[model samples]
Target: MRKKVLDVAEEAFQARGYHASSMGDLMATAGVTGGALHHHFATKKALALAVIEERVAAAVEETWIAPVRMAPSAREGVRSVFAAVAAELERQGFVRGCPLNNLAHELSLADPDFRIALAGIFSAWRQAIADKISADQRAGRELGTDPQRFAALAVASYSGAMSMAKTAQDASVLRDCLMGLEQGVMSSKAGTRRRSRILHRAL
Candidate 1:
């Protein structure tokens, strides 16, 4: 029952925005009575916190960690992460932006805890990318830029692009972002190879 309430709360927060979603709204959506809600979550903020935690866990699992684990190579896996996000946006017709981002934009100002929790999620995501890029670099896979900086930039750009796509109601913005990202990755690979050759010649 607690899990069910959290699930409904997450969807409600995503759809209605944190400020606009009330405890009453959550109870109605979850099909649980007021007693059950109060028993599990004493306050709306408590429920909201739970929702944020659950969302962060899910996003990490489904988007960041899962893709890297499933891909044949780290570089290819990073690209596929962007590709999967694009596919999801296209499928949803650009109606929904990222849930964590949405909450960050809407409720972070009001709740410091919310901000901290969401920031942790974002940091984890960025670190996941960085770790993958670093692995690829150590393995002699050419990624053109500094692995840490490139990973940070990629995650930032992807998030911003998703936001722009949602605002513009155009899935093409996401597609274009992915294309540009792909180009960046390719260029980085080339640069790595060039540097390797230069070092070889000097040796």
Candidate 2:
């Protein structure tokens, strides 16, 4: 029952801003009574936090971390990650932007707890990408690359693209951002390959 409430809340919060979504609203959507809601969550804030901790965090992990973890190359992994997500947004018609970012923009400024929760997710995401880039750098696959900077750039770029797509009601905004990112990464890789060829010829 707790999980069911949370599932309903997640959808509602994403569709309707958290501030606008009341417990009464959720009760109606979830088909639960007031007693049932209070039984699991003492307050609306508690329920919202749980939604962030569970549903939103899990989405980030599945969308970003898992893909990076399973990739054969960190560079290609990052590119493919963006590609896959952009394709998904396009398929969905870009009507819905990122849930985490949506909530962050809506609630981050109104409360400290919400800010902290969203910031933690962003930190974890940035670290995951940075770690992958660092590993590639160590392996000489991305020599001279600043992992931290690149990770920040990637996150910023994606977040900004999502916002633009949402505002324009066009998935093409995300697709363009993903394409630019992929081109930059592939170009860097190609430069590395050309350098290797030159070094080999010199030797």
- Give the per-residue lDDT of model 2 (tens digit) for 70-129: 787666767787777777777776567788899999989989999999999999988888
Per TM-score, the best of the predicted structures is 2
C-alpha TM-score for every candidate: 0.86, 0.87
Q: What is the C-alpha lDDT of each candidate?
A: 0.78, 0.85
Candidate 2 wrongly placed segments (more than 4 Å): 182-203
lDDT of 1 by residue, 1-203 (tens): 99999888888777778778888878888899999889999999888888788765687669867797667666677678777777777777645777877888887788799889888888787777778777776777644557677777777777788789778877677668877887876787688789999999999
- Displacement of residue 198 (Cα, Å) in model 2 is 17
Q: What TM-score would candidate 2 get against the native?
A: 0.87
